[model samples]
Target: MSKMQPKIISTLKAYSKDQFFKDLTAGLIVAIIALPLSIALAISSGVTPEKGLYTAIIAGFFVSLLGGSRVQIGGPTGAFMVIVYGIVAEFGVAGLTIATIMAGIIMVLMGFLKLGAVIKYIPHPITTGFTSGIALVIFSSQIKDFLGLKIGEVPAAFIEKWAVYLKGIGTFDPMTLAVGGLALGIILLWPKVNRKIPGALIALIVTSALVKILNLDIATIGSKFGEISSALPKLTVPEFDLVYIQMLLPAAFTIAILGSIESLLSAVVSDGMIGGKHRSNMELVGQGVANIMSGLFGGIPATGAIARTVANVKNGGRTPVAGIVHSIALLLILVVFMPLAKMIPLTALAAILIVVAYNMSEWREFKSLLKSPKSDVLVLLITFFLTVLVDLVVAIEVGMVLAAFLFMKRMSEATQVNIEDFDASEEKDGVPVEVHRFDSVDLIKVYEINGPFFFGAADKFISALGELGEKTDILVIRMRHVPIMDATALHGFKRMIEICQRQKTKLIISGIQDQPYKVLEKAGLIDVIGEDHFFTSAVEAVDYANKSVKAHKSGIDSRVL
Candidate 1:
């Protein structure tokens, strides 16, 4: 009922043996699915494949045990590949460890500060733009291993990486190419044959065995990276100097933001599938806790994986037990099958990742978004190019800023003010000759304003106010449509009032909406202008001003005067 109650607690309160059996089956399925993907992500991120397994085992367990969503399965996902690789390129594995731990701390602070809801305000165009860009980068990265090209470490830039890879095309191993293609074919075709067993696991096993028994001349995990430590991850805190910590802050922030977005997106998808709602703040806290634990255990940044979460939902996983079981299954596999993992061919992992990248690319959505509104298209392109040519950190920042500016432009366009000649407008509508005869002709000025009076529209509205005629004895402003106002606009309004007062003109504001009315009240503008000056209707304000003007003409405004 409270923060103390994780979703797991509620689910387990109604737990049964039947649910356990279903959870166990679902967990095993997800673990098999997670194994190859985790290893691939780790290698792409410039870490040993075993660290991916550790993340799946450690982070996966804690996320399910403490997370706010029922079906979210947390682990190493494709989103981190670019950022993790860049961090590793600049600062070694120790530096990465420090960044991950600091990122974990930042996430925890965000959760505690109730910043999860705030993260939702991050625009969708920016997310989609970066996602597609990452997908392209990932796909390009796999080109070297997929073709078994003997290229030295490829440059991080997209074009540069391709140039390096293209130069080494002559060194492609025929046997490795065959293995990668065969693995890809098996994965693409396996799902139609059977849904219970995963295509990835089958591809990994068959490809690894083929390479081993055939004595194929190809690079493998063992040959390239050497033997992976089969032992459990031990507790070791990475020492960091202040200089390095400061250097890693940008990288850490990137990880935290990306992890939070990915995890919450997965959680939201799971919620839709299960007809349930997730506690967003609690989920953030849970993910933060999971990342902290994962880093401590020598693992990379981990978050809820949408693919795994969906698989869990489809396989009768109704509660957190499925995620827990998935973690346990991975742990058992790591311990028992640690030796066999080394025999896995690099090309085979590359094949699996190529497929992963293709699916993650979301090219269809990218193309469609290009045909969208001009602002959206601009944001998409800026984010896309920046992600490929520069870095993810810059892409997100610039995209957000660009989107904000476009949004302000639209808001300003919607807000408008028009100064109408009271006599002319009344005459055109055939209502005013009689009214003007009774009230006073060309003596009162009316300004009509519509939409929000935020900062963007402040200057224009202020300029228009200063253009009021010197002959104006009374100024009536129609604000029935102004839904909101900020300090800048309020200041503009006060200045306008001051000018009217200096010219010895009375200002009457009519039909202001509730919010702006309250704002003016709070700013003491209402009292300064006199509460009697505000009228509930335009007609009333105009009538009151007419009476005052008439009184002034007769030298009867005040006896003291």
Candidate 2:
């Protein structure tokens, strides 16, 4: 129950006036950065721009107050844009809301279960793969806006999307192109001129100003979606339907997964920056709650935004107060200046997303991955193409499976078997004698098998054991190097024991410890061979074998006529 709730009730202190000033500056900057992005992302996601502000206000505030990270800023992110757009298109806002709520509940449950540590288990390569793929998808989705191309219906598949894009190359909106290009230029170049102000906000302001003053025949948000609302969102519930729920489940799952990944990644990044550890499960729960609230209030899906989190850190924002302040700033702007938002151009928002897609691609990492081993490269490429062409869910499932299979293969290959002449004969007639001219009466042969005894190497072990000659009095199976045993090897061990019993020879186990010993004990190998026959070392087994052989010889001598 404690795990389900926030660990600390009160907020951390900023410690200095300078820190407070920095927090205020940083909060304002991040809010400025978030404003255009929230609206642009909302537009891209097939929702109203005001809903985006609503999300940044309500969801962003709650996430910070209850979140694990000290500086994480939660809101609508590009990661959810594709999935959210699909959900809204198919199931409408009501269905999307319900799905988001369902996902939120799942996240709460995940937090209570304390699955924070489990985030580490998600492979780095897999995350990079899907992230890069989503980047490509975002980039592709924006081609229509960037080039102002007109296509009747864009295909969802990657190959088809490109085909449609290529077909519409002739019909480009020149004014739209100019606006997008200029916006991209400002966003890229603004940081060099001023470090404090966000580039995206600058681009939005400049581009919107130009479009309005010049009276360019370009598509503006107001022209397309009408005037922006200036009031806070009213709480509402989605009309529940089994079919809509079923239809939106995939989108919901994508949001949930992407949210988990992004939020955890953001938390990790902030942890590194602030020298503090974050509760991953708690962060996930916060994101879930944020998203649920955002949906109920007619907003888009929200998660921890990496850029905003970094901004918060850089600005000396040491506590959740900065995050709360950021929400307040957005709320103030939404309520006071929503009328002015109508003047923003759609091409400007599209340009923002175009920049977003470029950043998200992580092309440098993609190039580095090209040099990785074949297994990793394959998984990466497969996930990338699947995300761009097929669906995020499909890409994730296939990538995970491939990664797991490759991991198991590597583990299996570590186990090995070796064969050697344990029992030898004298050079009788130049033949390495059929039976060993033993220096000791023990006549115990030792064969050492190393590595895990999984199915991969079980066959080799069985074949090696099968080669034992009939003259052998006893075989000492040395497994000091073996670390693990699986059912397949256990079955092989049973067969080996039976073969020894049938040949009227004793089978002794030596150097068994840890997992091998436990498995052997559970499999009844010790019971069948008699616990006394199992030795801690090969020398002990040999000594036992010698004693048994001497006793047998004495018994035989007694029976002689």
Best by TM-score: 1
Q: What residue runs in model 1 are displaced by over 4 Å at the alpha carbon?
A: 1-5, 421-438, 558-561
lDDT of 1 by residue, 101-127 (tens): 888889888877878788888887889
Clashes of 2: 1
Worst 10 contiguous positions by lDDT, candidate 2: 433-442
Q: What is the lDDT of residue 390 in candidate 2?
A: 76
**Against the true structure, whose lDDT is highest?**
1
* Cα displacement (Å) at residue 247, model 2: 4.4
Q: Give Cα-based local distance difference scores for all models.
A: 0.86, 0.79
Q: What is the TM-score of each candidate against the true structure?
A: 0.94, 0.88
lDDT score, candidate 1: 0.86
Q: Please give the distance, in angstroms, between residue 310's alpha carbon in candidate 1 and its true position after superposition.
A: 0.1
